[model samples]
Structures are given as C-alpha cells and as structure tokens.
Target: MPQLLMIEDDARLAQMVGEYLEQSGFVLTHATDGKAGLALLEAPTAAGLPDLVLLDLMLPDMDGLEVCRRLRALPSDAARLPVVMLTAKGDPMDRIIGLEMGADDYLPKPFEPRELLARIRAVLRRRGEAAPSARIMRFGSLEIDRDARTVTVAGEAREITSYQFDLLAALAERAGRVLTRDQIMEAVRGRELEAFDRSIDVHMGRIRAAIEADPKNPKRILTVRGVGYVFARQQD
Candidate 1:
C-alpha cells in the first residue's frame, strides 16, 4: 500500500480524510503543522518517506509555500517527493503558485472525499507507472527516464514537478508531432483541461526553463500559433 503524509491544522478534517483514504487501501499519517511535517520528512521514520504529501496552503507555522520550497531543496530523494496542495483559496493564482512551488496537483477546500481520493490515486499512478515503451528516452542532450521519472539536460538533472514531467514526456515521446491543447491534456493523466485553462502553458514554460538553453526562445519545444506545441526532434 502507498503511504501518505498530510500536513493540516484542521484535526477533524485530517481525521475524516485519513479515514476516507484508509478505506481505499492507503495508509495516511498526519501532522498538525508545517514544522512537524518538515521534521518528519527531514528524518524519515522506520516507514521511510511517504509516497506523496498532501500539503495545505495555510499551515499554522511556516506557510505551505515556504514549506514546499524547502521540501524541494532537500538533499535527498525526498526532494522529488510528489506533492498535492490542498488550498481553501479559489484563486487560480494560488494553484499556479503552488504548481510553480513544486506541487504535482491541487484540490480546493471542502472537496468531496471521493474527489480527494481520485486526485491521490491519479498522482500516485503517474509517479509509479513506467511506460511499456522504452524506459529511458533520449533526445540529443535531453533525457527522459520513464522508470525513474526524471529528466536531465546534458547529463544534469533538471527539476520539474511530476505532472510537468509527464507533459514533457508526452511531447518528447511524440517529437516533431504537433499536439493540440486538448491532445496534450488527454496525454497527461491526473486532471482535465478545465475552462480558462492556462495550466498547460504554465507547465510548458516551466519545462522549457528546465530543459532549454534559453527559455525565451526554446528549441526543444516549439509553439504553433493558434494550434499547439511540438517537441523538436533534434536539439542543439
């Protein structure tokens, strides 16, 4: 069973969510605040680090954004740990900032337990599944390892969130093919392209920043006006 760690101040809510997830075959552990959560993550217990983190945006101690930044800075495999932000804020900026800060996904507050469960399953599924195709995909200096779920540019690892990595893989797998926004969204699992959808663009920009020599003028992923994007078949 996959292990989960949720950092939330709302004890009742945590209890409800933990129980709900437990019934679905997940083992969820809880921390009331960000500091304790960070501590637990820094020095994992006998169970080791959890497979994913359900981080709340409004932590009582350090803000969830700061926690996420620190989490990504860890000098261990835990740094790449998948995160799903749980925010009460409806602002799209909150979700965007969370994604930029390294969250794999986000769910708004007062969500149905079923929705939460779905989100959790989707994230874990993406992180765990290695495509039946070649496990390691290489394009010139850029490399995408499906088995390890990592991307490297010129042999140096580039940091990208789980969902963003999946998006890059989808494009890279079909290099030179122009995939429409709808097609891109369909390629990546976890979430659909909702109304006012700029998530794909945001994630693409982040991916370019990681893999391109110059994000302003990317050579790896090219944009087609009024259409979609295509990953370059060859890189300089």
Candidate 2:
C-alpha cells in the first residue's frame, strides 16, 4: 500500500478526499496547512517517506508554492518525492506556475475524487515500475543506459530510480508524440489497469530531472495541457 499526504487548510475537503482515496487502498495522512505538512514530511518515519503529496495552493501560514520549492531542493536520495497541487484557482497561468514551481501535477478544487484517485495511482505506478530495457537510450546529450539501469547527462552519470528510467525510455522511444495520462500509464505498466490514475506525472518528473537542465522550465517532456505529455524534441 502506497502512503500519501494530503495538505489542505479546508478540514472538510481534506477529510472527504482522504476517505475517498483510503477506500481505494491508499494509506492516508492529512495536514491542515503547508507548514504543518512540511513539518511532517521532514520528520523521520519508520518505513520512510510517503509515496506522494496532495498539496493545496492556498494556506494560512505560507505559500504552498514555496513549500514545494523547498521540498524539491532536498537531496534526490532523500526520497525524490512527487507533489500534486490541489487548488481552487482556475487560472491557466496558475497551473503553469505550479508546474514551474516543481509540482508534478495540479488539480483544480471541486474535482472528482475518481480523478484524484487516478492521479494518485498514476504517480504511484511510476514509482513502483522499472525500465523495460537494459540498452542505453540516447537523445542528444542525454544517455539512458537501460542495461546499466542508469542515466547520464552531458557524460556525467545521474542517480535515478528504475521507475524513472522506465518513464524516460517510454518517452524517448516515441519522441515528439503526445502521450496522454492514460497512454503514459499504459506504456509504463505495459498493460491496462483502470484509466483514471495520475502516476504518469510522477514518473515524468523523474525523467525531467534526468534530462532537463531546469526541470522547473523543462524544454523536454512538455505537458500538453488538459491532455498528456509530449517529448518536446523532434526525432532524428
């Protein structure tokens, strides 16, 4: 069972989402503010960190965006945690800003619990899977050695989990094509499950770190807005 942390100021909404996702088999943790969520995340856990984060952009104490920036600044080995911003603000610019701030995904408030569950599953699936090949995959200065199970950027080796490697291979294999959240989930899993999961964003985040010089402003692995992901570069 993958653990999840839900950070939102609205107690009622938090409880609703927590209960809904819990019913879907995910263990849940809740925080009423971004500061409190940050505290819990920094605290040690016997089994380690939660698999994913559900963050609310509005907070009483501090901006959720700042918290996300600080979290991503942590050492990669600390967890490579993925965050999903849950906001009521519907501005498209806000969504883009959240992505720039390192959020793996964003869900506007009043969204369906099923959509949230799907997003959670998508992120978790990426965390749990492994690369499909051992052969090194290349795209420009990036090199992902599937066999070595490692990635190299500018000839320097990078630390990436098996899931991350797998996500990168999937994108590289079909460079320039837009892969919807469902398409990515299928490619990563190599089969079908429920079509509602959002783990693809999590896996894509890992890939962004491997190849993008500035993941906050990724030039590769670009989001297709309300659809899916696209390998921003053209094929050879």
Candidate 3:
C-alpha cells in the first residue's frame, strides 16, 4: 500500500478523507499544520518518507505556498517530493500558483472522493514511471540524462521540479512533433486534459525558464498557437 502524508487542518475533513483513503488501500498520515507536516518530512525515520504529500493551501500556521517553497528548498530528497495541494478557494489562480510553486497537482474544495482518488492515482502513477533509463538526449547546450533524471544547460544544472523534468522529457522524447495539451497530459499523467486546464502551459513556462538561455525567445520548445507545443529538433 502506498503511504500518503496529508497536511490539512480541518479535523473533521481530515478524518473523513483519511477514512476514505484508508478504505481505498492507502496508508495516510495526517498533519494538522504546515509546521508539523514539514517536521515529519524532515525527520529521517526507519520507514523513510511517504510516497506523496496532499498539502492543504490554507494552513493555520503558515501559507501552504510558503511550505511548498520551503519543502523544495530542503537539502534532502524531500525537496523533489511530489505534492498535491488541496484548496477551498474557487479561483483558478490558486491552482496555477500552487503548480508554479512546484506542486504536482491540486484539487479544489468540494470535490468528490472519487475525483480525489483519481487525482492521487494519476500523480502516483506519474511518479512511478519516473524511473531512470539509459537514454541521453541533447539539443545544443541542453542535455537531458534519462539515467540520472537530470537536466543541464550549457554544462550547468538547471533547477526544476521533478514533475517539470518529466514534462520536459516527454516533450523532448517526441521532439519536432506538435503535441496537443491533451496529448501531453496523457503522455505525462496517463489522463486526458481537463477543460480550461492551463497546468501544462504553466509547466512549460517553468521548463523554458530553466533550460532556455532566453525564455522570452525560446529556441528549443516552440509553441504551435492553437495546436500545442513542439520541441525543436534543430538547435541554432
């Protein structure tokens, strides 16, 4: 069973979610605040860290975004840990902000348990498929080493979240092909794109910032207007 750490302050909702997830064959550890969640994450226990984190954006102690940023700043494996933010805010910007802060995914409040389960499964599945391979891809000064799960530009390591790395890898693997948002989502997460979903675009911007010398004039990943995006095969 996959272990999950849920950082949510609502006692009753946490109980309900914990029960549902446990019944669905997941082992859940609940933290009522961001501090507690970070503490648990930093502790090196014999059991190791949980497979994923379900972080609540509104926390009693600190903003969930701060927690996420701190988590990514950690000098340990916790930095790259997969996070899915849970928020009650209805604004799409909240979701986009969370994604920009390195969250793998997010679920708005009032979501059905089934949808939550599906999201969890999709995130976990993506992580599972991130195993190292022997293939190495290069374009100009950019290098993607599948065996090490690392990306470098001009011989310098580029800082990117693990999910963003996967997204870039997916696009690079199909270089020169214009892949629709739906196709990119399916390739990365094994799920269809949701209506009005701009998560892919957000991730793409982040990836470009990391790899492109000038993100404003990206040469590797090119946009295809209404179609989607393509990784350029030729480098100038």
Q: Which stretches of candidate 3 lie above 4 Å from their native place?
A: 133-236
Tens digits of lDDT, candidate 1, 1-236: 57799999999999999999999988888999999999988877544568799999999887899999999998765788899999898999989999999999999998999999999889878876743468898887989999899998889999999888889998877665567788788887565444544768988999999999999998788888787887766546
lDDT, residue 216, candidate 3: 92
Candidate 2: residue pairs that collide: 118-196, 118-197, 118-198, 119-198, 122-198, 122-199, 123-198, 123-199, 134-146, 134-147
Model 3, 87-193: lDDT tens digits are: 99988998888999999999989889889989999998887688544399887788999889899988899989877888899888766456777777777775344
Q: 91-183 in candidate 2: lDDT tens per residue?
A: 999889899987888999889999999887887676557434437667678877766777888899887777676777777665545666766
lDDT of 1 at 29: 89
Positional deviation of residue 209's Cα in model 3 after best superposition, in angstroms: 48
Q: What lDDT does the true structure give each of the candidates?
A: 0.85, 0.74, 0.84
Better of 2 and 3 by TM-score: 3
TM-score of 2: 0.54
Candidate 3 yields a Cα-based lDDT of 0.84
Off by over 4 Å in 1: 130-236
